[model samples]
Target: MILGEFWRGLKSGIVELLSALIAAGLLFALGDSAILATITLSSFSSELKSESVLEVFLIDEITQDGIDSAKTYISSLSGVSNMTVKDPEAAMDEMSAILGSDMTDVLGFNPLPFSLEVRFEPGSCDADYLNRISSGIALRDEVMEVQYASEWLDNLEKLTRTTYIITGILLALVIISSLFIFVSLHRHISTRRRDIVRNLRLLGIPPQSLIVISMMRAIFVGIIAGAAGVGITILLWKLCCNYVVTIPFLTTGFTVLAIAAPVLLALISLLISAGRSQSNLFASGS
Candidate 1:
């Protein structure tokens, strides 16, 4: 009978329930955005220990001798991340794919330079320090056009900032919406007070039964929200993978907690509401 009732109510109330659950799912997505920004900011704020990963692309042309000499020069730099040499031909091939043309034809020659990739400790990503290091290297007679830029960090910072903003907005919406769920449920129960009391008093239904039923309903909502939330998040992750590092939708712990916590909270809130409503009904009948 309870299962039948649940299904009946699900069909009738599907629209409202789904809207609320989807709102919950949106919160899950924003959770990831917040996670990424926090991680990135922490990475930037952390102190330098030994070395950091730095990638430098050379767009200028150079001879094999120059490549070897550049490698030698970079090897001598203090606190090098790792000096890997990318040849101009390799760079040109990559450029062609990105540009969709033979850049060499337009330029009349290979303009790609053999740039040294220098990695330093975490703190070394600073613009002023990087400029000093690169410029200081360029002053060497053999080095040509060593480049470092504050602009290099701009795009990364902007991306994290954007994520932070989106997360904040979505998080607020989710919180407001989650709280709305309790309000809606309470209103529905109050409106159905006659039906609820008639059935309970007629059947001598224990208070525990109502509480358990509400808990079950909450679990159902949570499962749907978790599944829907995870599915949407994965779809987005796939789309972003083409251009950026799209992290996995939810780590195991977060997935479990996201599903569990909201369900528990909803069940508890409804249980309390049920008790208060039932108390009023019993009092009025007396």
Candidate 2:
């Protein structure tokens, strides 16, 4: 019966199937970890960028109306996310809290000028954009100075770029390794079933049926491998959850990909193997 032959084929290739499963599972885990780390770094980068603030100090001669106008102008700027006015008194209070002593007691008068704290949108935190915005704000008559930590922003930008490059390289390597594993496993399966396949072909069995059987076997192996990979990844993620930050949607998406990747790879491998085996068998017969 066909069922008996299918069982025999499954039993014969059990070792190859197990090897493929183990190799694919480990590779998938490595790939998932790299992706998760990249996402976490990106999240941290965005958070730090959101905290960046530009301080615009007002001239001593500027009236309250002038201060209000400056605030309104800065708030209306294209990239500005937020703008808060801190009067001289508030500035003094903040300095006092930092020093743990009343600044007024030592200075007799607040020397700090009224300033606007401006925060920009994430993509707008680059050095060039910040410089342009700061220069524009400085040109205003009421503005005495515009200051921000440009050096810090530059360094953060560099770090983000490096993370992206490294993540891309890692993903590429994982994909290549996965393809190699699938191809090698498919070849081994083809060799093991060579005699049986040749016999079936001579008996007038349709080539399509043989290809489908091989594909089914591959699909079965892939499902088992994908399940193992996903389980391992979930376990490792839980164990390291305290140290790593992850987005819920990203994690869910990666998990789905992990399960889907092996099956997809298997399908590709079976198609390749089927073509090669059919050709070799027909050539020998002729």
Candidate 3:
């Protein structure tokens, strides 16, 4: 198929596959970007459970003065974004609302622990660092059990990792499916090889002309497939991830680049395939 064939299919294949190609393109963008988002989460230790302010288990205790001092120390640490110590009274009130009982009555003499909350900067939440801090505090006899929401952070990390893995598998499926579609279309035209040869022989046309025609068709197909895929990918990402991806640094531009880059590469691949098939036409003519 040449450029003329691409035009021929403008009404036929292009029109038919336009929607599907775009849809596939959108899926390709989402799945690929989803994995990136998840991987980014993993790369940043900010998502740690210790970062979570709420938890169900017993909390470690610290004096107001000691907690304040700890806060200052943690703040100075690299990767520490922010930190706070929620007083026992505040903790009790929050628990009271959730537990549906007067924390005063429920605890009687039991006092809510004066727990410290530390918000780490983007990179501070390493296991070694957290453990070092926890162990250092636990050694102080004045301090109760040192507690922060590490469990929730762990779960978040796992969830992010899982999302990336699933996205990767799905994207592989899309690539395979797209290649199958492209190659299948190539095969359909190739099946009419005898007729193409007979026609060329009768016209006394150069075999190179036929090759040019097929290659020209491939380029048109690539452009159509690429453009449709890119358009659909952007449209879908705008609709779906407008809010979920809240990072200020991230942009729709990356999403568009992600979609367009791959599609263009695929188009180039189609061009190469077309070139390869051209040799066959020349050989048969000889």
Candidate 4:
């Protein structure tokens, strides 16, 4: 009997049902896209940070003993993953290869200073820590200069943080909009079926059963619409990966939540609307 009534309600409001489905699907898709962007940006930023290296230049006149001392000091510092010392001649050679000619020959001197190419561990590449290390290294007698892509790293971190904040706001708005949509859909359907609901109540049908049937209809719509949204998001993600840069899609846990969230929202709306309907579904006839 419950299933019969549920099907009847669905068929009677085909137009409204389709509208709700489309709206809900779009909301879900928007939410999914926000999540994907947050994940991809975070991953990209981490990769860049891990690969970043700090360059420390030595004074031209520093002896080999001073070079060994500097290397020992830097190696003992926390978060120093690895270090490679480039002698003046080696640095000149590298610069010569890049410029297609040796500046040493043109100037009658190899003026490039010795330097250390330093790479840090995963979590210690932030601006503040690197800046502190650079300051300390610069004060050493053998050190000429300390430099790294500090500005670039700072910008990348800011960009990742901004992406996260925007994504969070977008998701919160999506959830709020979804709730409003579900509430409106419930009211619209209930208003249209008022007469049938009143007659059912008069015939000794329990209000709880009526509410349950309505909730069942909501669940049905939620599942179908949620699946549609997931499909759309997947299609978009695939297109992005093919034409644009590649990024991994939603994980299993997030995919499940994307489908379940709409259903949960629908059920919540029905419960709220049912609470306000009193014992009888009609406003005047109750």
RMSD of each: 9.0, 3.1, 6.3, 3.3
Lowest-lDDT window of 10 residues in candidate 1? 45-54
Give the lDDT of residue 104 in candidate 1. 90
Estimate the TM-score of every prediction. Answer: 0.52, 0.84, 0.59, 0.82
In candidate 4, which residue pairs get closer than 3 Å at backbone N, Cα or C atoms, i.e. clash? none
- Residue pairs with colliding backbones in model 2 are none
lDDT of prediction 2:
0.78
**What lDDT is reached at residue 229 by model 3?**
54
- lDDT per residue for candidate 1 within 1-286, as digits (tens), equals 5665455545556667777677766766556446644655646543332233344543345567766766777777666657766667887898899999999998899877665656665554554456556776676555666644346454544655676677778666765666567547644644554475457666886666555555666678767765666666666766766555555434688667666666665665566666666455465762
Instruction: For model 1, state the Cα shift of residue 249 in Å.
Output: 6.6
Q: Residue by residue across 105-141, what tens digits does model 2's lDDT show?
A: 8878788999999987875566667778889999999
Scored against the true structure, residue 199 in model 4 reaches a CA lDDT of 86
Report the candidate with higher lDDT, 1 versus 2: 2
In terms of lDDT, the poorest run of 10 residues in model 4 is 277-286
lDDT of 3 by residue, 41-97 (tens): 665545443354321122355455666565565556565566556666887888788
Q: Candidate 4, which segments miss by more than 4 Å at Cα?
A: 61-69, 72-79, 122-124, 127-129, 139-142, 203-208, 238-247, 278-285
Query: lDDT of each prediction vs. the true structure?
Result: 0.61, 0.78, 0.56, 0.83
Task: Give the Cα-based TM-score of candidate 3 against the true structure.
Answer: 0.59
Name the runs in model 3 displaced over 4 angstroms.
1-51, 54-69, 86-114, 122-142, 190-223, 226-255, 258-262, 280-286
